[model samples]
Structure formats: C-alpha cells, structure tokens
Target chain A: MKLTILGCYSATPRTLNNTTSQVLEINNHMFLIDCGEGTQVQLRKHKIKFNRIKHIFISHLHGDHFFGLVGLISTFRLLTREADLHIYGPKGIKEVVTLQMKLADSWTNYKLIFHELTSENSELIFEDDLVEVHTIPLNHRVYTNGFLFKEKEGDRKLDINAVEAANINIAYYTKLKQGFNVKNNDGVLIDNKKVTTPANKPKSYAFCSDTMYKEDIVPIIKNVDVLYHESTFLEKHAHLGPKTKHSTAKEAAKIARLANTGTLLLGHYSTRYDGLKAFKEEAQEVFNNVELSEDGKTFEFN
Target chain B: MKLTILGCYSATPRTLNNTTSQVLEINNHMFLIDCGEGTQVQLRKHKIKFNRIKHIFISHLHGDHFFGLVGLISTFRLLTREADLHIYGPKGIKEVVTLQMKLADSWTNYKLIFHELTSENSELIFEDDLVEVHTIPLNHRVYTNGFLFKEKEGDRKLDINAVEAANINIAYYTKLKQGFNVKNNDGVLIDNKKVTTPANKPKSYAFCSDTMYKEDIVPIIKNVDVLYHESTFLEKHAHLGPKTKHSTAKEAAKIARLANTGTLLLGHYSTRYDGLKAFKEEAQEVFNNVELSEDGKTFEFN
Candidate 1:
C-alpha cells in the first residue's frame, strides 16, 4: 500500500503549503480523502492520474476539507470521464455539490453517486472481496467521520512440489488453496496444510483528522498498520485544541500510544507553527514510531 | 493603472497553468475579478496583500470563474479580517455561497455583502471618488458580464510656480484646482487656466472573458486604455468558438480593432495550444497593439 500526502496544512492554503487532502492506494483502489481547495493542482503536481480516483471521502463540511470537490467534479466532466465516481461524505455534501452543478448548468455525463453519511456510531461503509472500509465516528465541532481501510485476508498459497508429492488432482488443488482437506485420486484424505501454506498477513490503514482527543476512537483504530491523525497544535497551544475541537501533537501521540498503531503519521498542521520538527518531537515523547506528513510526501507500507 | 493576471487558462487549472482570475488595480482600489480555484494561493505567490482586496467581481457561475470564492472568504474569516467584503456576481451567487457557510456553520465575523446581478443590460455596479465600475453584458452559455474599470477625472494639477508668480491667495488654490475662476487677494478675477492645467487623461480598463464574438460590448468598452478579452482558440478552431460560447484570437483582435482599445490583452487560452506566441501573432494580425496574458504577468497602463 502507498499513501501520498497531497496537502497537510490546516484552515488555509499557502504558496508553499496546502490544506487537508491525501491519496491512498490499496488493492488497486485510489481513494481521495478530504479534498481541500487546490487538490486537483496538487494531484497534477504529484503526477497522480486524475482518472484513477474512483472514490472520494470527505470528513466534514469545512471549506478547508471539501471545497475543491465541486471543481474536481467539473474537471472530470470537462475531461469527458466516463467512469462512475462515488463520493462518501456528510449528509449535506450532496446538496452542496449538486447545487453548484445546477447553477453552472453542467452535469456529468457519467454516473455521480453520493453516499451521504449521518451516523454517529462506527459502522461498515464499503466492502469488496479484497478490502473493507468502516467509518470511525469522531468528535468535532461538526458531524465528522474518519475512515479505516483494511485488506481482507487472502487465500492460502499452494506449494506445487508438495501438492504433486501428495498426488492431489487438479480439482483438489482449488480445495487445498481454500485450506480444506480433500480426498486424492487413490481415495486417501490429504491434509491441506501439508500441501499449502498460509498467505501473508493483511495490512490496514486508518485516517483520522479534524477531530478532538477522543478515547473512543482508540478502540476502533486499535492495532492498525498505519494511523494518520491530525495534530493541529503543539503543547504550548494545547488549550486551543479543546476549544476548536482539534488535537495537539501530544494528544494525537497519546491516542497513537493507546491504539498501538504500527506508525503514527501526523498531519493537518496549523500554519502558525514555523516548523514540523516540534510536532514529531512532541509525538515521539509518547509514541516511539512517528512520522511527519508534508505536502507531496509519500509513504509506502509492505 | 496596473492589471495583474493571476490565472489565464480556460476550462481547468493545471499544475503550472491556472484558470480565469485577475487583479485590476485602478486608483487606490484593488479589484479582484473572476476568482478561480487556487486563486488564494496564487494571490499569496504573487505577494498581493489580501486586505487590499475589498471587492471581488465574478464573471459568472462557472466553476473556473468562481469556485475559489468560498475558500477565499473562509480564509478571510480565519485570518480574522474585520474589513467588509463585497461580492458582485450572478443572481444565484448569494444562495450558493451562503448555503456552504450555513452547512459548515462557519459564518464570517466580518460583514460579507453580496451584490447579485440579474440584468442583461450594461449597468453601473460600483463607484467611488476616483474609480467607477460598469458591467459590460456579454453573450455566453450562461448569464455573464465583463467589467469596465475607469479612473474618474481628477482635480487639475496646479502649476505651483505659475500660481506663486500670479500671487494667488492660498484660499483660492482649491477653487483654481477645481477649474473655477476665483478672485485674487487684490480683488482681481484670475483665470483658472492661467494657474492650473487639466489633469492627466483618465485611464480605463475593460475586462471581457468567456464570451463569444459579440460586438454589443464594443460600445460599452470603446477606446479603453486596456482591454482583456478571452481568446480560447486560434483561427484554425474558429468554428468551435461560437459553438462553445468562446472566442478565437482573431475574433478578440477584431473586437479590439472595432472598439479602438489602446492595448489588447488576450487571455483564457485553451490548454490544447502549445504556446502563447501563436495567440499573440494571431491577434496582432488584426490589431496593432496586442499582448498575450500569462499567469503571473502584469500590465501597467500609463
């Protein structure tokens, strides 16, 4: 899995920095998260294929989180994209986007499906044969949700030499891969473990942003391979976190420590801070594995 | 008068190219016209002061023209701007903008005044002591209007040496500057022309964009100091101009010639073209003074 940080700043977009937006590639799916203003330009700058974005997930209705959505949709129409696009966001997202399109008198030739989310509890939102996505209800000033993408466990790998030694027929090979004991041609029952080995462990990623320090989410995102949490403030400005319903670096680190995530990625930084080193330092004091997210940066997980 | 091109491309913004937007500075007011997406970042990249932009004029409801408006307004609120902001656009602009703010529950602390335009005829929209703005209704797929910014004629410049030589009383200086004959200290009627000369000729700039080859606006923007007209295509694709409600470089130059504009500035070029030199060459064929507008390019009119 590969994740690209299209933008990581908060509130406003600057010349050198952008607001909240990211692209995650998992199991052949490119999911766009929180498309802030100027996200299309950032995608182009990062050389990401625009047509590859099939699903878009918006955390909330903030301008910094989803202002770029309508423009990106119009661009898709301009490019004559025929692929059906799915958008998962707050309940008001559909009205906001369709109104703009109605005013412009420009409608997409392709199917534009909207999955409006209004639930206050964690629930499964999307699932396929290879992956599953669930909503992680977050505490914020507005109705917001973080997403957790997890890869489903795969079928067992077949050992060709062991299968041949066991005299397993081609029809029984499928059963062996499914970890089922099957009868061979000689009417002898063969154990599936002798002919096949277990597949590699699946990986999971959780994205959380624009939220306050809520301990409830820690249980939901526990033991994820990677966790991207918003750290909009430092320890000095920790008081503003609760007031704004945002998280400080230390608070995000505490959540990371509680969840026991493999990696804690910090992003959505407030522009008031001069550098990102302080956030990493503060997060590292509590969580040993921490990384900082910047615009145009990419991270890969095996 | 100075006009800065914040974005010049049409349809969509690219990694290096931007969409339709410009900053026209006349007298002491800085007028922002057609705020496309990424305009705030472009404003910062060009080092334009945000507070100086008190008024924003959107050409139409198209995404390329006004998608960045909400984000810009939100940024102003985030910056805690106290100045009142005036937005002039189509009739549906207020509803579109206010709905987003209402959904996000992020209303601006500063006053946000909307001047929605529904008229198809040319009309005066803004006026001050030194500058006056009028709308030049253009023919397009949607209701659209181009803006004409004219510097009001200033007070006559008093020839200090000539006034001193005439022994004119300081009290009568204001009357002389107002081009009125006033009595001197010796009770002699002094001619105003003898003490003061006429002020520099008023400079005007007309912005026309996203329109077809319509000549109705020629009378409204006639003989302006500078004229920025959209040239979305070249002569080879001239047939597509009218169909798309756009204009070719030759058509823009023809309008420039017919209106007798001082300098013809061509912008809003389609991304299909390779370079801007072809547009300049094509426009120069019909008009003597023609220049292509590029992102970050600025034009100063004397």
Candidate 2:
C-alpha cells in the first residue's frame, strides 16, 4: 500500500501550504480523501493519474476538506471521463455538488454515485473481494467521518515441493490454495495444511482528521498497520484544541499509543507554526513510532 | 488602471497553467474578476490584500470561471471579515454559492450581496462615484457577459493661477470644478470652462472572454483604452473556435480593430499551444497593438 499526501495544512490554503487532501493506493485502488481547494492542481503537480481515482472519501462538509470536489468532478467531465465515480461523504454533500452542476448546467456524462453518511456509529461503508472500508465517526464542529481501509486476507501460499511429493494433481492445486482438502492422484484425501501455508497477514490503514481528543476511538482503530491522525496544534496550544474541536500533537500521540498502530502518521498542521519538527518531537514523547506528513510526500507499507 | 492576470489559460487548470481569473485595480478599488479554482492561492502568491477586494465580477457560471468563489468566501469568514462583498454574475450564481454555504454550515460573517444578471442586452450593473461597470453581452455556449469598467470623469483640473487671478472665492471652487458658473468676489459670474478644463478623458477598459467572434459588442466597448479579449485558439486551430464557442487570436484582433481600442490584450489561451508568440503574431497581423496575457503578469494602463 502507498499513500501520497497532496496537502496537509489546516484552515485556509496559502501559496506554499495547501488544505487537507491525500491519495491512498491500496489493493490496486486509488482513493482520494478530503479534496481541499487546489487539489486538482496538486494532483497534477504530483503526477497522479486523474483516472485512477474511482472513489472519493470526504471527511466533512468544511470548505477546506471538500471545496475542490466540484472542480474535480467538472474537470473529469471536461476530460470526458467514462468511468463511474463514487463519492462517500456527509449527508449534505450530494445536494451541494448537484446544485453547483445544476447552476452551471454542466452535468457530468459519467455516473456519479454518492454515498451520503448519516450514521454516528462505526459501520461498513464499502467492501469488495480484496478490501473493505468502514467509517470511523469523529467528533468535530460539524458532522464528520474518517475512513478505515483494510485489505482482506488473500489465498494461501502453496508449498510446491510438498504438493509434488504428495502426488497432488494440477487440478487440486486450486483447491489446496483455497485451504480445502482435495483427493490426490491415488484418490486419497490429503490435508490442505500439509501442502499449503497460511496467507500473509492483511494490512490495514486508518485515517482520522479534524476531530477532538476522543479516547473511545482507540478500540475502533486498534492494531492497525498505520494510523493517520490530525495534529493541528502543538502542546502549547492544548487549550485551543477542545475549544476548536481539534487535536494537538500530544493528543494525537496519546490516541496512537492507545491504538497500538504500527506507524503513527501526523498531518493537518496549522499554518501558524513555523516548522513541523516540533510536532514529531511532541508525538515521539508518547508514541514509539511517529512520522510527519508533508505535502507531496509519500509513504509505503508492506 | 492596473490589471493583473492571475490565471488566463482556458479549460482545466494544470501544473503551470491556471484557469481564467484576474485582478483589475481601477480608481483605487481592487476588483477581482472571474475567480477560477485556486484563485485564492494565486491572490496570496501575488501579495494582493484579500480585504481590499469588495467586489467580484464573474463572467459566467462555468467551473473555470467561478469555482474558487465559494472557497474564497469561506476563507473570508475564517479570517473574520466584517466588510460587505458584492458579487455580480448570472442569475443562478446565488443559488449555487448559497447552497454550498448551507452544506458546510459555514456562513460568512460579512454581508454577501448578490446582483443577478438575466439581460441579453448590455446594461449598467454597478456604479460608484469614481467608476461605473456595465455588462457587455457576448456569444458563447452559455449565458455569458463581458465586463466594461470605465473611470467616471473626475473634477476638472484646478488652475490655481487662473482662479486667483479671477478673484474667485475659495468656497466656489467646488462649483467651478463641477462645471457650474460661479460668481467671484467682485460679483461677476465666471464661465466654468474658462477657469477649468475637462477631466483627463475618462479611461475605459473592457474584458471579454469565453465567447466566439461576435461583432455586435463593438458598440458597447468602442474606443476603450484597453480591451482584454479571449484568444482561446490560434489561426491554425481556427476550426475549433466556432465549435467551442471561443475566439481565436485573429478573431480577437478583428474585434479590437473594429472597436478602435487603444491596446488589445489577448488572454485565455488554449493549453495546446506551446508558446504565446504565435498568438501575438497572428493578432498583430490584424491589429497594430496586441499584447499577450501571461499568468502572474501585470499591465499598467496610463
């Protein structure tokens, strides 16, 4: 799995800083998250194929989170894209996007599927054969939801020499990989585990942003391979976190520690801070593994 | 009058190329024209003060023309702006913008006044003491209007020597400047023209974009000091101009020549061309004075 950070700044977009937007590539699917203003330009700058994005997940209705959505959809139409696009966001997203299209009288030729979320509980939002996505309800000034992407377990690996020694037929190889017992060339039943090993552990990634320090979310995101939590402020500005419903670096670290994620990625920094080193330093004090997210940076997980 | 081209390229915004958006500074007022996506970032890059922009003029409801408007307004709210902002655009502009605000649940603290236009003919839309703005109807695939910004004639120049020699009262100077005959201290009525000359011929500027070669607009924008017309295609791609409802460089120059504009500024170039020299060459063939607009370029009209 590879994740690219298109933008990571909080509040308004500046010349050098952009608002929240990221591209997560998992299980051969590219998912766009939180398309802030200027996101399409950032995508172009990053050289990400526009057509690779088939699903878009928005955290909230805030301008900084989803303002670039309509522009991107319009651009797709201008490019004459034929692929179906799915958008998962807050309840009001469909109305806002369709209204803009209606006003401009420029409707997209492709199918635009909107999955408006109103559920306050953790529920499965999207699922396929290889991966499944669930919503992590977040506490913010408005109705917001973070997404959790998890790869499903794959087929078991075949012990070729052991299978050959067992006189397993080529046709039975498929059944062995599926962890099922099959008859060998001698018409005798053979145990699947004797010739096949279990599949590699599935990897998971959780993305949470624009939320206050909520301890209840730890169980929902427990033991994920990677956890990206918003660190909009430093420890010095801890007082403003609750007031603004944002999380400080220390608060994000606490959540990361409780969730026991393999890697804790920090992002959505407030532009008021001069450098990002302080956030990493503050987060490291609590969590053993911490990484800072910068615009245009990419992270890979195996 | 000063005009700054933030982004002048046609169609979707790319890495180095931007969509249509510019800033026109006339008579001490900073008027923003056609805020395409990423305009707020462009404004910040150009170091233009955000609060100085009290008025925004949108040519049409196309995504490239006004996609950045909602984000800019939301940024104003985040900045705690209290000034009134006036937007003049097509009739459906209000519905589109207001619906986005409703979805985000983020309303601006400042007053947002909308002036919807539905007229197919040229009409006056905005007027102040120093400047007046009118709509210049153009032919396009959508209901589009170009903007005509003209500086209102100022008070006649004060000839201090002539006024003192005529024994005119200082209080009557206001009346003389207003082209009214004023009585002097000797009780003799003085002719206004004898003491004051006409205000330096009111400078005018016309901006037309995303329109085909339409000759009817010549009368409305005739004799303007500077005319910025859309040149979305060059002569080589002239066949695409009529089909796309866009003007070519040669076609733009034809309109400029017919209108007798002092300087024809060509912009909104299609990204297919590698360089703008071809556009200037083609335009100068028809009109003597033609200037190509580039992103971040500024033009000062004196």
Candidate 3:
C-alpha cells in the first residue's frame, strides 16, 4: 500500500500550505480521506489521476475537512467522468451535496452514492474479499469517525517443487494452497507445512484527524502498519483540554505508543506554529518511528 | 468603485486557474460578488482583509459561482468573527447554507442574515445613503439576477469659492451639498453648482454573469462605469444559443455595446479554449473598451 499526503495544515489553506486530505492506494484501489478545499488542484499538482479516485471518506462536516467535496463532484461532472463515485461521510452530507446539484440544475451522469455514518461503535463500513474498512469512533467537536483500513490475510502459497517431490496430484494443489495436507492418487500422506508457504502478509492503515487524545482508539487502531493522526497543538497549549478536541504532538505520539503502531505520520498542524521540528522532537520522546506529513508527500507500506 | 478578481476562470479549478469569485469595493464597503471554491484561499492570496467582507451577493446558484459560500461562512465563524454577515441570493440559498451549518454544528457566532430573491423585476436589495444595490434580471438555467451597484447621486458639490462669492450662509452649505440652491443672510441666491463641485460623481459598477445575451438588462446597466459579463465561449461556439443559457465573448460585447458601458470585462472561460486572447479579439469586434480578467487582478474605477 502507498499513502500520499495531499494536504495537512489546520484550519485555513495558505499559499504554501493546505488543509487535511490524503490518498491511500491499497490492493489496486484508491481511497481519498478528508477532501479539504483545493484538493483537486493538489491532486493535479501531484500528478494523481483524478479518475482513479473512487472512494472518498470524510471524517467530519467541518469546512476544512470536507468543504471541497461539492467542488470535486462538480469538477468530475464537468470532466464528464463516467465512473461511479462512492462517498462515506457523516449524515447530512447527501442533503448538502444534492441541494447544490438541484440549484445548479446539473446532476452527475454517473452513479453517486453516499454512505452516511451515524454509528458510535466500530463497525464495518465497507468490505470486499481483500480489504475491510471499519470506523474508529473519535472525540471531536462534531460527529466524527476515523477509518481503519485492513487487508485480509492472503491464502497460503503452494510450493510446487515440494508438492511434486511429495508426489501430490495436480488436483490437490488447491488443498495445499489452503494449508491442508493432501492425499495423492497413490494414497500417500503429505504434510501441509512441507508443501505450502505463507501467502502475502496483511497490512493495515488508520486515519484520524481533528480529534482529541483518546485512549479508546488505541484498541481499534492497534498494531496498524501506518497511522495518520492529527496534532493540532503543541505542549505549550496543553492547558487546552481534550474537550477543545485538539491534540498536541506529544499526545499523538502517546496514542501511537499505546497502539504500538509501526509508523506514525503527524499532521493537521495549527498555522500559528511555523517550524515542524518541534513536533518531531516532541513526538520522538514517546514514539521512535514518527514522521511529519507534507503536502504531496507519499509513503510506501508493506 | 474598485473590482478585484479573486478568481475568473470557469468550468472547474485547475492547478493554475480557478472558478468565479470577485470582490467589489463600493462606497467604502467590501462586497463579495460570488463565492466559488477556494475563494478564501484566493482572498488570502490577494492579501484581502477577510473581516472587511460584510455582504455577499450571488448572481446565481451555479456550483462554480456559489459553491464556496458555505466554506467562507464557516471560516468566518472559525475566526470568531462578530460582525453580522448579510447574504443575498436566489431562493433556497438560506436553506442550503443553514443546512450545512446545522450538520456541522458550527453555526456562526455573528448574525447571518439571508435575503432570498424571488422577484422577476428589479428590486433594491441593499440601500444606504451613499450606495444602492439593485437586481438586473438575467436569463439563465435557473432563476438568476445580475447586480447593479450604483453610488447614489452624491449631494451636489459645494463649489467653495462660488459659494463664498455668492455670499451663501454656512447653514446653506449642507443644502448646497445636497445640490439645492439656498439663500444667504444677505438674501443672495447661491446656485447649487456654484457652491459645490460634484459629490464625488457617484460611480456605478454592474456585475452580470452566467447569463445569455438578453437585451432586457441593457436599461438596468446602461452607462455603468464597469460591467463584468460572463463569456463562456468565443464566437466559434456561438451556435449554442440561449438554450444553453450562456454567451460567447462576442455576445457579451454586444450586450456591453448595447448598454453603452464605459468598459467591458469578460471572463468565465471554458477550459476547452486554451488561449484567452481569442475572447478579447472576439469581444473587441463589438465593443471598443474591453478588458480581460484573470485571477488576482484588480481594476480601479476612478
């Protein structure tokens, strides 16, 4: 899986910075997270194919988080896109979007589906044979939820040479891939582990933004290969409670440490702070594998 | 009167171009013409003081023209703006804007007043002592109206030297400024023109966009100092008649010429045509004083 950061600033979009947005490419599927304003322009600047974006997941209804959704949809229509677009967001997204379309008198020719989320528990929002998406309830100013994308464990790979040496029949190859000992035509016993190897390993990514430091999300995002979390404040503003619904760099690292995540990507920085080196220094005190998220930056995950 | 082009392109925002939105400075008040996507960012890029924007006038509800209204409104709330915001647009604008605010649970702290336009004829939308705003009925896919911002005829200028020469009393100064002749203590008749020059020669600016060439608007915007007309295409695509509810550059110029506007500013270009010079060339054929608008460009009418 490859992750690209389209924007990571907090609140406003400046000339040199942007708001929250990211792209996750997993199992040949593209998913957009938190499409802030000017995301399309950032996508174009990063050379990301606009048509490849299929699934859009919004964290909340905040202007900075999802205001660009309408423009992106309209742009898709203007470009005459025929591919169906699926948006998973909080409730009321459809009404706002459809109302704009009704006023403009221009509706999309392709299928436009909105999956509104009002659930408070971690539930499967989307699932295919290869990938599953679950919501990670977060504490924020509004009804917000983070997403956990996990890849299913792959089937066991068959060792053709070992199977042949064991005299396993061709028809028994399927059983071997399923990690089952197979009986050949000669009625000989075959060990499953001797003739089979492990298949591709599963990977998981978690996305969280505009949320306070909450311990509950640790269980939901535990052991994630990568975690993209918001760090809106610094330790100097620790007096601002989690009720403010904003986390500092140290708080984000604490969550990553508790979750035992492989890597932590921090963003959603308040514009007040100019340098990001402080964030790294603060986060490194708790989590060793921490990195800053930059616009148009991409990451590779195994 | 001053007009600032925050964004002038049409169709969709690209990495290098943006949709429709402009800032009109009239009678010392900042009025937002349209709120396209990325308008706040454009406002920032132009170094415009966001708080100065007190009123917003939307010509129509096309996504390209008004999609950014919600974001701009939300941004004001986030910035803790206390000034009341007044919005005037077609029917349903209030519903759409308030709906988003309700969903996000982030309504503005300041008063947000909505004035829905339902009239088919011209009506005064806003009026102060110095400025008056009227609707210039337009023909489009939806109920639309262009805006006419006219500086109310100023109080007659008191030609100071002429007033003294006429022995005009100081009490008659206010009357002379109002363009009225008043008697002095000496019973001398002071001509209004003799007392004052012109009260700044009330300037007028008309903004018409996303409409076909309709002769009906000529009388409403006649002799306006500056007229911004939407030109989505060049003469080559003029075959798409008023049915499409759009005008070519030449068609826009024809309306400007018919209205006898001081200068014609053409914009809202279709992305299909890469070169913008064609629009100027096509418009110059009909109107002698034609200007091309681009993002971040400003026009000062003096």
For every candidate, the chain B TM-score is 0.99, 0.97, 0.94
Better of 2 and 3 by lDDT: 2
Q: For every candidate, how close is chain A to the native chain A in TM-score?
A: 0.97, 0.98, 0.96
RMSD of 3: 2.3
Q: What C-alpha lDDT, on a 0 to 100 scale, does residue A134 get in candidate 3? A: 94
Worst 10 residues of 2 chain A by lDDT: A96-105
Q: Across residues A1-302, which tens digit of lDDT does each residue of candidate 3 receive?
A: 99999999988777788889999999888999998988888888888898999899999998888988999999899888999999999999999899989988889988999999999998899999889999999999999999999998878998878888888879878878878887876898878998889988899999988899999999999999999889988899876747579899999999999999999999999888879999989999999999999888899987
Model 2 lDDT tens row, B1-302: 99999999988889999899999999998999999999999999999999999999999988899999999999999999999999999998998888888877778889999999999999999999999999999888889999999999999977888899999999998888888998999999998888888878888999998799999999999999999999999888999988989999999999999999999999999888899999999999999999989999999999
lDDT of 1 by residue, B1-302 (tens): 99899999999999999999999988889999999999999999999999999999999999999999999999999999999999999999999999999989999999999999999999999998999999999999999999999999999999999888888889888888889988877888888899899998999999998899999999999999899999999999999987999999999999999999999999999999899899999998899899889999998888
What is the lDDT of every predicted structure here?
0.93, 0.93, 0.89
Tens digits of per-residue lDDT for model 1 on A171-264?
8777787789998889999888888999778889999988999999988999999999999999999999989999998899999999999999
In candidate 2 the C-alpha lDDT for residue B26 amounts to 94
Candidate 3: list runs displaced more than 4 Å. A157-196, B158-172, B182-187
Clashes of 1: 0
lDDT of 2 at B52: 98
**Ten contiguous residues minimizing lDDT sum, candidate 1 chain A:** A170-179
Candidate achieving the largest DockQ: 1
Report clash pairs, candidate 1.
none
